[model samples]
Target: MSVEATGETRSVVTAATIREILVERAGVDPDVFTGNELLSLAELQIDSLAVLELQAVLVERFGVEIPDESVTMTVGEIAAVANEDR
Candidate 1:
């Protein structure tokens, strides 16, 4: 429950890490994208199963548990939350 031992945490998440994950999962080039851009499913060509995979990857990488119901249908939301956690 304590984040003290893990050292200080930051309120903002790094754009680089999020970009990397997006590139890896969504196949969108991170170099051309910014965090503010809305990532639609059609744009990323992501399906339902891919979404679950992305969620798992986020949880595993960031140590944050995102409820299945809370996983928005847009990549932007996921990036925002993950960035904050990071």
Candidate 2:
């Protein structure tokens, strides 16, 4: 399922989608992710700057607002939060 906001269509938030955004927007190596891994952002080596960029991408592409506390969550958890916002 997808969400439409401001006349833009956004994909249903998922771990794969978040991973793709990280890879595309933050230059994260796709090989470094397992999609379903229950690792925190720190474990994934995502720094504060990357988190900020990810937040921006999430808002722009998914129309999801990620809270400050969610920044340390796993990709899956973050995806869940975005999906909930939808």
Best by TM-score: 2
**TM of each candidate vs. truth:** 0.52, 0.79
Output the number of the lDDT-best candidate.
2
Cα TM-score of candidate 2: 0.79
lDDT of 2 by residue, 1-86 (tens): 33354575557888888888888998888887765387788887878777888889988876788877665799889888888845
Residue 8 shift from truth in candidate 1, angstroms: 5.4
Candidate 1 residue-pair clash tally: 0
Global lDDT for candidate 1?
0.56
Cα shift from native, residue 41, model 2 (Å): 0.8
lDDT of each: 0.56, 0.80
Candidate 2 regions with alpha-carbon error over 4 angstroms: 1-10
